[model samples]
Target: MIDHVYISVTNIDKSLTFYSSALKPLGWKVFGNYDSASGPEGVPDLYGIGDDMYGNGKAVGSSVWLRQRKVGETGLYLGIVCDTNELVDAAYAAAIKAGGTDEGKPADRTYFAHGYYAANVADFDGNRIEFVHKAWNPKRHV
Candidate 1:
């Protein structure tokens, strides 16, 4: 029921480094890129950038990208589904090491109650990404 999600970033290189490493364990990969494209027309416009968003003679500014199909975005969460809470914790730790600012430490949400461990990580643009495990919160309405 969803097509794609777009996020704005201040630094594509840094965002790339952080996301590439962080999302890898979750099975996401950079499926498309427009760093070599010419102008706004070459990039997706829904992300909200001007004609120079990519900048002239340099591909260092905003960019148009796509991630391989996985989960859907609900409201404010990224909705990651992991095999276990332990993996969630590991991913959270990896995100912190990959230049992503930690938004929350791993914890159990008894409301969901299985092993639901989740943590928030901020991208270079301050976009919040979440790492989650359903079992951590069995009462989380699974």
Candidate 2:
């Protein structure tokens, strides 16, 4: 399992506003923030956002951190899982309202398999964000 993930952004405040709005529909909220001086050795400062109810018994749940982008740094893509297709659509709209560029509108990606619904958007920093809902049945797959 992934513990956490971080992405570099050109502007922290702008990115925060973008993410807070874009991810709200998916049940994520801004939870924490850290400065470069307070970060662990060799780690950059970041703004943390994620689902509060996740990883209840563990040290931490899945989270995405937005850090200040360094010179010549490249961006990264992220995929967030949604519980339902409606959430995917909502997230996509929210992202666009938050100043994100639409990569692909919400639709079924049959190539991935049946019941695969997703939407793609590019954040202000041009990082790709995908909201996906996959109706997977473990018993059936097995």
Candidate 3:
């Protein structure tokens, strides 16, 4: 269970637009915005991590506000726990239509074999977020 996940981004408004459009269908609403300095420099921290990680990049139609990291950070997957696979697909589709680039398309994943379906999408910032449902099998050692 993740309380929140944070990343640096370049643009704020475009990120909000793509997320607002893509996340709407998945029943995830932007509960609030974090505009304070404690929040990330460009965009405020967003709530509703349980929704498809469909809109976790910089805002679209804007410049890449942050410098690209040479080595990508491999953080825990921000899983959305959708009610069904259809919701996952819908969120992914909507995100792409709203200016998100495909990190990966919707599909059944083997790792989360217990009925997990998910897809990965990038915001304008190039951060990777995944839309997932029923797809987690964490081992104790892991």
Q: Which segments of model 3 are wrong by more than 4 Å?
A: 1-77, 135-142
Best by TM-score: 2
The whole-model lDDT of each prediction reads: 0.49, 0.74, 0.51
Per-model TM values vs. the true structure: 0.39, 0.47, 0.43
Candidate 2: deviation at residue 130, Å? Answer: 21
Total backbone collisions for each predicted model: 15, 0, 7
Residue by residue across 15-107, what tens digits does model 3's lDDT show? 656665665786555545433445324332343322433233221111112211234543333444454678789989998999988977888
Q: How far out, in Å, is residue 100 in model 1?
A: 0.6
TM-score pick, better of 1 and 3:
3
What is the alpha-carbon lDDT of model 2 when measured against the actual structure? 0.74
Per-residue lDDT for 84 in model 1? 65
